[model samples]
Every structure is written in structure tokens, then in C-alpha cells.
Target: MEAWYMDDSNEDQRLPHKLDPNVPVTLEELQKIGVFHWKLNADIYETDPELQKIRDERGYSYMDIITIHPDKLPSYEEKLKMFFEEHLHLDDEIRYILEGRAYFDVRDKEDRWIRIAMSKGDMITLPAGIYHRFTLDETNYTKAMRLFVGEPVWKAYNRPADDFEIRQKYVNSLAA
Candidate 1:
């Protein structure tokens, strides 16, 4: 996993448009904003003790796998558009990359965009109601495992969702 300020280029979303000055975001910085990351052995993830411990500790009882690729997903373009839309979920968004690569852009404390580049063996947990978006990197392919505390909720509230209690809590966390 790697993170840096994203350049405001109109090029393909898959391209790594690293800012010219190359401001990098450290893992500690991500944690300050409620984003957590882990690196696990993807090949043995199914039986990895570390992953099992996380699931057990976090009470993530439900899990599903998704492969985001033009050939694998129906309405691929539409889905990508939706995924790229700045939005927040009612529940924590946890994903473990099992294959390929992607980028998760999150809003920093000052609302600046921090792009997190993830690849196989990478795992990330985005706290509920944090404004974020995801897209495949140059590879245009990614297989990920999604974990949930209970039944999965697919609903996404597009930005300006400040009214939601989860969003409020997320904002308050930043101040702490």
C-alpha cells in the first residue's frame, strides 16, 4: 500500500497522477482520519490467522468476494461510475484485495484528497461515513473480499450526507 496527494489531471482514472511535488501520506496520517490498513499474504488469506483474528475481533460475520473487471461484472461502466462517485456508507467499508490493484481516494482532515494505492495482499477498513471513492488502477482489474458485521448493506449516500449520525461521528473523531 502507498499513499500520496493526487494530481488534478483529467487523464484516465487508472493512471497514477501523483502530484508534482509528491506529497506522501503516511500510515499514521491515515489512522488519524479513521482509515486503517493491513498487509497480509493473499495466497493464504482464507486461513491466515491475522485475518481470522481481525474478523473475529471486529465481529465481521459476513463476507463476499467481488471481481471488478469489464468482463466479469455486468454493467461494468455504470458500476465504475457509481464507485467513483464521492459517497459514504452507513457501515464500515472493509475490503481485502486478493488480486490486481486499485486506488481508494479519501478526504483528509482538511478535505484534501489522499489517494491510497492498493494491490494484492492489501487490506483496508474505511470507517463508516467517511467520504471516499474507489477505482481500479492501470490494471483495470481487482478481486476483493468484502467483510461486514451483519447482513451487507449496499446503499451509498452521495456526499453532502452530513446529516447522517455516522457522518457526524466520523467528523467528531477527526477532532479527537
Candidate 2:
């Protein structure tokens, strides 16, 4: 729903003094609180059949829930390309960057692409059907934590995007 940038990143966002320790988290707490992480809920997604196929092929049932971390990623462009092109079956593509820099380009309902930048301690939640793309640079050395809100569990990027065809059988299977 929102992106949270590192506290130190906003040197000008600080307040005067601290707040009452017993008080609830307030403006002063927010301004002074360091950026830690971000998260997305699962109730927002609308499933796609392709996602179910990927799950079945992977010896899983549903691409229901998943988390993504950039730093722990492997170094494979081909694999990365496929990973990115495949649309998430669960619909809501969520992420929280723990470290580094990156940008996400997502397609809206009107077919418009919107790019949201992410850095350490940033959070982003992508609603279902919002086609999305992500890129990481040398400076993009980042680490992220993700949460998926679907059933079974599980579920990235590179190269020119590819088209994914949906078969009627798979759709029917998913519907059932």
C-alpha cells in the first residue's frame, strides 16, 4: 500500500525530541522510527490459471503465498528472465526491500505502466491484474522480504518480456 524509506535517508524528516515512552506510536515515533520493512496482504489478489500450472509443475498446488529477497538471489539471467515474465497466479505481487536500490514498473488497468522506486526499508503492495516488471542494477544490490496471501504457497526478472498463453484446460482445472 505504501513505501517506507530508510530513516537516515530522510535527514530532514526528523522531529525535535523523543515522545512519551508509554504513549502509543505517534507522529514523533513515526518520524524518529527507523525504516525497517514493508508488507502486503493476500486478500487483494484474483488468481490466474497460469500461476496454478507453475505451482503444479513445481510439485506444488497453488502459487498462493510467496516472499522475495533480492540479495539471496542466484546469478542466472535466463532463469531470471523467465521468473520475471511469468505473471503471478495469486494476483497481488508484494515486496519489502530490506537493503539496496531497485525499481518496479507495473501496468495499471488502463494498460499504463507506472514505476515505483524501492530502497532499503521500503514496502510495496501490487494489487491483482497490475502487470509488473522489476530491475536491479549494480547499485541495486538490495535485500527484500515478501509475503503472499494465497493458499498453497510459493512463487522475479530480466531480458525483454515474454507473452504467456493460457490454455482452456488449465483455466478449467483452476476453476474446479
Candidate 3:
């Protein structure tokens, strides 16, 4: 996993968000900002009781696996286009990488992009209404577990102008 300021010139300044695998942060610190990361035990499995307990505690009602590769993407071109495009959902977007790598470009408090590179054992949840986009990293492949609070609804609002004001206010608040 990796995180850094997107602006190449300001490499030394610290951002409001942090990207440290060793630092432990609170749930409020995570959920309010619309982004969170956690490292899991390397040997974790889908059927593990610990994972199930987490699911129950987090209110996740369903889960599914998604694998993507160049060969598999041809048949999923339209769907891939949607994901690569900047968009937000009405519910949090949660993913746990079971294998491979991908980058999730999430908008910061200042509306700048922060690219989060994720790989195996990295779990992330992007809170609802935050503008973000996803794409495979250099490997061009990823296998992830998608979790949902209820039945899944794969709808994305592609930069809807009407909600920007409200969403931006919420994002700003998170920064505060």
C-alpha cells in the first residue's frame, strides 16, 4: 500500500489525511473523512470467523468477489469505463483486496486527488457521496472482495452537479 500527495512539487508538506500502515486511528477519524484503511492478517480468508464478526459488526449484509485482468476486461469494457470515470455512490464503497493491485483515486478535502495504491490484505471503505475513481495498477490485475450493508446496487453518479455543494460541505467538515 502507498499514499502520497498528488502534487509533484509539494512533496514535503503533510496532508490532512494520513497513510500509515502502523498507525492506529479511530473509527470516527476514518468514517467521517470518507476513507479508511486497515491491514489484515496475511492468512485471512473469506470464511474466517473473525472476518464474519467484522461483517456483522459493520452491518455488511452481503459480499462478493471481483477479479479483473486485461483478458477479462474486454468483455467488461462498458463496466470498466464506468469505474474508471470519477463518480460517487449513495452508500459507502468498500473493497478488500484478496490479491493483486489497484489504485483508488479519492478526492481530498481541497478537492485534489490522492491516489491510494492497494494490494493484498488492504481493505478500504470510501464513504458515500465522495468523488473517487478506480483503476488497476501496473500489474493490470486485481481480485477483491466487495462488501455491502445490504443488497448491492452498482449505481454511480458521475460528478452530478446538483450534489456537489452539499457533498463538498460535508467533505470540508470532515477535514475540520
Candidate 4:
């Protein structure tokens, strides 16, 4: 429910990522995510058993959607505000966008936030202690692929992020 988009132009400027969603993003806008070298498994997208299992999981089903409103539309900002804030706990900020671009504001080791931009088809491996918030630039939308764990119960969790910590068993099972 963090969505707040006012029709007033003056208010919009004060908000982050000023543009409405997904009309289109340029090369310059795409360069912000720093540089990470992550590849995609062409075969797994449609045929991976692991991914298929995850698709059936409750969390994945809720967040994974292929279609979305263009970032350029008037309601774009309002839409983004809703998506990111829906699950805003910093315990495990695990995500990777597969078909568009997004900017992540993460608190680095020094606790100073570093804004890293990520493009479609990039894998984001976030370590612990990083606080992050995400954004999709104006005129742009995305189809993202992700990974996370489901906790049946809390077992001495230091924070909510502890619940999302990727288990080695799950990570090892994934085929490269």
C-alpha cells in the first residue's frame, strides 16, 4: 500500500523516479546498475523442473506476472509504489529481472546507500546486511524471474530476512 501518485505535477517531481512507467528506456538509463556478469539458461525458462516447481509455490505465483502496464501511463508511478512496497522487509532482497530494467537502492557495507541499475536478463545476488528498494524507470515495465525460500516457522531468526535466506540445498539443486 505504499503507492502514492498525485496528478499534480509539483508533487510528482518530489517523488522518486519521476517518469510514469514503461513508455521506453534509453541506453543512458540502462547503464545505472553497475556491471554484473550473469547469464541465462535458455533451456530452463520453459523446461526447467526446478523453476516449474517454484512457479507452483505460493510466493512465486503471487509475484510472477508476465504482463504489466507501460511505465509511461499516468498510473505507472502509482503501480510501482504498490509492487515494491508489498514486500518491503530487508531480510532477503533476492530478485532478478528477466525482461526489463529496474534500479535498486541498497545500503552498502558502510551503510551508505548505493543505487545500482539492473537491466533485463541480469541476476542480482544480494548479500546480507543490505537494505534495498527497487524502481522501474519511466515508460518501462518488466518480467522478472526470482528465487526465495518459504519458512514453515521461525527458528531463531535474527530478522525477517533470515526467513528468506536461500538454503544451500535449494541452491545446489539448480542446474546451471
Q: Rate the local accuracy (lDDT) of all candidates.
A: 0.95, 0.40, 0.72, 0.43
What digit string (tens of lDDT, one per residue) describes model 1 on residues 9-115? Answer: 98988888899989999999999999999999999988999999999999999999999999999999999989999999999999999999999999998888999
Could you tell me which 10 consecutive residues in candidate 1 have the lowest summed lDDT? 8-17
**Which candidate achieves the best TM-score against the true structure?**
1
Give the candidates in order of lDDT, highest first. 1, 3, 4, 2
TM-scores vs. true structure, each candidate: 0.98, 0.44, 0.77, 0.46
Model 4 ranges off by over 4 Å: 1-37, 41-44, 48-63, 66-76, 82-91, 151-176
lDDT of 4 at 8: 23
Estimate, for each residue in 26-95, the C-alpha lDDT of model 2 and write its tens digit: 2222222211223322222235344334335434332222223344455545434454462533334556
Best by lDDT: 1
For candidate 3, lDDT tens digit of each residue in 1-96?
A: 676445434342222234443333344544556688877653666567766777888998988888888676566556666687888887888898
Q: Is candidate 1 or candidate 4 better by lDDT?
A: 1
**Any residue pairs clashing in model 1, and if so which?**
none
Q: After superposition, how far is residue 167 of candidate 1 from its true place, in Å?
A: 0.9
Which runs of model 3 end up more than 4 angstroms from their true locations?
A: 7-32, 74-77, 162-169, 172-176
- Which of 2 and 3 is ahead in TM-score? 3
Model 1 misplaced regions, further than 4 Å? none
lDDT of 4 by residue, 1-176 (tens): 01221122434222343235423333332223221234354235657565456446425432333434564445766766654441224234445566666666544223333445566555554433333455664536766655545532212223234245443322232222
- In candidate 2, residue 74 scores what lDDT? 57
Model 1 RMSD in Å is: 0.8
> 2 or 3: which has the higher lDDT?
3
